[model samples]
Target: MITEAEKWTKEFYQKRGWSEYGPFIRIGFLMEEAGELARAVRAYEIGRDRPDETKRTAGELKRELVEEMGDVMGNLIMLAGMYDVSLEDMMEAHRKKLTERFKGETS
Candidate 1:
């Protein structure tokens, strides 16, 4: 499903005639993603400072985290599309790096 996300993003951009501004759009998307992350961190701080508040539950913080994660995924999908990179390939590369690092093969 996540791999298909990249394909859908490419098609969406193509349909909107946005292929020409891929680089710039991706930069903007990354900025938006960073803002969402900041918002999530602020929400976490708010919850952390009021642990005794029954009105603010852990579920609310989880929702905020998921929202920020969605933003990150969306931007990453867009960036991969802009660069014509496959999400599957990236994941494989990451897995290989993780395996090596965990095995003490490389730093």
Candidate 2:
């Protein structure tokens, strides 16, 4: 799935002429997406009112949060692709690092 996402993002970026952007630019985008995700989390927890609605429902907030999360993940995938790193490999390395660092600390 990560590989497929990377492939799709690469083509999508290229189609939009964003392929020329360097890792620095990609990182900026990733930061923006992270901010959006944070905002989504806040809205999901406390709720927010749209222009047409007095307040959003929990389900609505959750759906928006999921979309924001996807945006963050997509940006992350793009940034990693810029550095030729695979998300799948990164996840594996992260798991290994935590396993080694924590040992049996986790129950």
| 8-104 per-residue lDDT for model 2 (tens digits) | 8778878998878888887888899888889889888865555865677789889989998888887787777767779988898899999999997
For all candidates in order, the CA lDDT equals 0.73, 0.82
Q: What local lDDT does model 1 show for residue 91?
A: 88
For model 1, what is the alpha-carbon lDDT of residue 27?
79
Q: State TM-scores per candidate.
A: 0.63, 0.84
| Over 4 Å off, model 2 | 48-54
Taking the candidates one at a time, how many backbone clashes does each contain? 0, 0
TM-score of 2: 0.84
Predict model 2's lDDT versus the native.
0.82
Per-residue lDDT for 81 in model 2? 76
Best candidate according to lDDT: 2
Per-residue lDDT over 31-98 for candidate 1, one digit per residue giving the tens place of the 0 to 100 score? 88888788777777664455574555668877878888877776777777666667787888899998
Top candidate by TM-score: 2
